[model samples]
Target: MRIDFSNWKPLTIREVNNIFSRISIYWGVAGGCALDMHLGRKTREHSDTDIVIFREDQQMVYQLLKNEWTLYKAKDGKLSLWLEGEYLDAVSDIWISRDNQSPWAFQIMLMDCEQGNWIYRREKTIKVSKEELFSTEENNVPYLKPAIQLLYKGGSSQIREKDFSDFQSVLPSLSLKEKEWLKEALKRQFPLGHSWMKSLED
Candidate 1:
């Protein structure tokens, strides 16, 4: 069976929650899809879910998702991949970082179910409950605080237009400290409010 979003059994936002109610794994709803999940918007069909598998307990992460999944990378007779799906575009390297500064790029197993047209662009962040925010799994997938999420997205100029718009959309909910942090983070990145130059200073 191809790991296709088209054929993917539509998992309700709530269902995703219930499934992980007690899984001892470090995971999060990441990628552009995550943005949509929170906003209750029509996210583009995803070939696979972007999960942040911590550097440790990787084997366990694989065992959990190995069902009908494909591996994207392999090392020393071991598989280091990203994605529980078998799609190539659906599969990507995992990056986990803190302080919005350091990101650890690692390979992961990606099972691509089908070919896709649009590469997902970022945007949309809904503040869900705390239970939804934390991962109970054994993996070390860390949750990106609203501040860090905004900071990281804003720092990257190559970020898709949708992602930048998403950042702006979530701007109102950002805490004062988050805004300040974003300002500093982006300023260091793009010479301080280069795009919304005034917004950063304000």
Candidate 2:
């Protein structure tokens, strides 16, 4: 079910922490919110907050979230049950809420990783050391790097206006290495040509 609620209020960063901080799971901000967190400012309002968790740590997340929220497999624009202790073999996204009536609190991106290396889901060949996948703000909130977040947004042909805005804001601050990494990743995913690759070179 491509479900959306009438009172769909997103969780604030503080609210996000109030709930999940004690879970003891390897988690951090992802998506547009992450881009803003890395930039140390809120560029725009977010529809929902995204958090990344290792696929291996699914149980821990389930245990941490079970009592309060219902988890649903959000794939191909549809939502379904993400049962406890069940292997999330095909789905990589899960949406959490108190129930269908309430606003969605957050979404979880289940990522693949090995040892301490963070694997790029779109291109398995590309891997980044865990040390480089995320960085912390002055307030200690961890977020996905800008370049990586842009890489994810780049995959869709229907890239939203907000995503383009995020690219513009983040591109200038990206280091030479970060630019190069994003260029290479984009090249692999959009082999023919991608607008962002040219900008990255400049």
Candidate 3:
């Protein structure tokens, strides 16, 4: 089916928190939205919001939203209806909307994990404990740490203008430890070098 990319009306952070309140598994706001949450203000307008969950918990999330929302598996530049109990092992992006005709609401991104450590899907060697991976905002909403979110943005093949904007907006807020962790992660992920590495240095 043809999906309208421009028809995105993402949910607010508080709305997402209420929707996922019943979920007992590991999940948190991710992507640019998470970075904004860490900054305690909306740095810029976002086209969509992202919620992240471990791959292992995909089914649980699927079951939760399946009845009330339309779920589509987005892979290989295609969108298809996500069937019940369908294991999207190779897929990481899932687009959700209130209904087929409604504007897209938010995206659910699946992350790889082992034991209790979060693993970077692009690079297995990069992992961090759950505590280090997420931080709860004063509003009681959980979000991916700014440094980790920046790392994800840096991994994009073509860094967009917004990605750099997010990096710059959150840089001053990051602790020394966070900067060091992100720098080391970028080093391992891009052994040759990354433009952001120099900015992350102490």
Estimate every model's Cα lDDT from 0 to 1.
Answer: 0.44, 0.83, 0.90
- List runs of model 3 lying over 4 Å from the truth: none
Order of the predicted models by TM-score, top scorer first: 3, 2, 1
C-alpha TM-score for every candidate: 0.51, 0.92, 0.97
Model 2: CA > 4 A from native: 5-7
The numbered model that scores best in lDDT is 3
Candidate 3 lDDT over 57-152, as tens digits, reads: 999998899889999999889888898989989999999999888999999999988988999987899999976788899988889988889999
lDDT of 2 by residue, 54-102 (tens): 8988988898889889888977878887887898967899888898677
Model 1 lDDT per residue over 1-202, tens place? 1122122233343444454434675455555545554444653554444454333435565555356334444333433444553333323353221112222222232221112211112212212333433322223333335444555455565777766676666666666876776666556556534574466556
Between candidates 1 and 2, name the one with more favorable TM-score. 2
Which stretches of model 1 miss by more than 4 angstroms? 1-22, 33-49, 73-143, 191-197
The deviation in Å at residue 117 for candidate 2 is: 1.7
**Clash list (residue pairs), candidate 3:** none
Provide the lDDT at 139 for model 1: 35
Q: State, as a TM-score between 0 and 1, how close model 3 is to the true structure.
A: 0.97
TM-score, predicted candidate 2 vs. hidden true structure: 0.92
